[model samples]
Target chain A: DVKVTQSSRYLVKRTGEKVFLECVQDMDHENMFWYRQDPGLGLRLIYFSYDVKMKEKGDIPEGYSVSREKKERFSLILESASTNQTSMYLCASIPSGLVTTYIYFGEGSWLTVV
Target chain B: AQSVAQPEDQVNVAEGNPLTVKCTYSVSGNPYLFWYVQYPNRGLQFLLKYITGDNLVKGSYGFEAEFNKSQTSFHLKKPSALVSDSALYFCAVRPQSGGYNKLIFGAGTRLAVHP
Candidate 1:
């Protein structure tokens, strides 16, 4: 069984604050992704890392950055958190070289920017 | 550009009744379609996927999806509905070209099962 863990389940921050959401996957998958879930918007990708030190922007990457210093850990960073950034963030991973494999996701971190 | 569309915003069904969630997609090349379910305050969980071969693909928790190439649809179905099956469902698509590894998701449909 693959396990994807999010460091924080809930967070609250004031406007213009810097926020970090951490994720770790035990499967050592090569593809890791960050997504935000909002009501009526579903889940939109923020950023994804295909390998260590490699990152790519997703559909909605504005105001957000990601770090993949290690293979097992991926972090999502909000340069300046705003109320619009308040939403549930999810981390996902899939093993490399498998085109048909589905992504495994963490429980998700709920961020509240006030 | 790949995209997925879930037509229904909500679906209500009674326990032991059949349930269906509609989804359609568009992509440049061959498309890999997937269905995911999310409980309240949780991340999306993979339910089923359609890559190739076998238009009807069975998946976890007695869920299945049928891929209709002519219609460009992959609609999820269940024989019988359970109260526990109620959740937010999302349909996603990823192009097989170059293994892009990016999944485009739909707005999602909320399933409500009444006992």
Candidate 2:
């Protein structure tokens, strides 16, 4: 079975603070993604990494960055967290670039910015 | 670009009754569709996927989906609903063309099963 683990289940940060959310997948998936899920708006992609050191912006990538230094780990960074950034963040990984591949998700990190 | 739409925001059914969660998608080429379930406060769980071949895809918890090419629909169905079946269901799609393709998700339908 594939397991995608998130470093934190719940986190709190003050406005303008820097925050980091980590995700690791045991399957050695080549594509990793970061997304923020909000009520009504659904899940919006933040960033994605297809390979080490390679990143691409998603639908809503503002104020967020990602790092994939290794095949198993992917990190989402909020350079300056804001109250509006408080949401459930999800990390997902897919084994390859094929569109038929299914993406696996971590439990999720709930960020509260005050 | 690929996209998905779940026409209904919620679908309510009673226990022992069949239920359906509607999903439609738009993609330029062949579509790779999927169904996922999300319990509150938890991440989305993969239920099933339609890559090729069969139109009827059976997944965990007795959930199944039918892929219709003419309607551009991949509707999720279950013979009988259980109370535990209540969850947020999302339908996603990706184009068959290869690349770093992302799965486009629908807003999701909240399924409520009453006993």
Which candidate ranks first by TM-score, i.e. highest? Answer: 1
Q: How accurate is candidate 1 locally (lDDT)?
A: 0.92
Alpha-carbon error at A96 in model 2, in Å?
Answer: 1.7
lDDT of 1 by residue, A20-93 (tens): 99999999899999998888888898899999999999889999999999999999999899999989999999
Off by over 4 Å in 2: A97-99
Specify the highest-lDDT model's number. 1
- Candidate 2 residue-pair clash tally: 0
**lDDT tens digits, residue span B1-115, model 1:** 5678888999999999999999998877778999999999888899999989999999999999999998999999999999999999999998887554568889999999999
Q: Evaluate residue A7 in candidate 2 and report its C-alpha lDDT on the 0 to 100 scale.
A: 82
CA lDDT of each candidate? 0.92, 0.90
Kindly report the interface RMSD of candidate 2, rounded to 1 decimal: 1.2
Clashing pairs in 2: none
TM-score for candidate 2, please give it: 0.96
TM-score of chain A of 2: 0.96
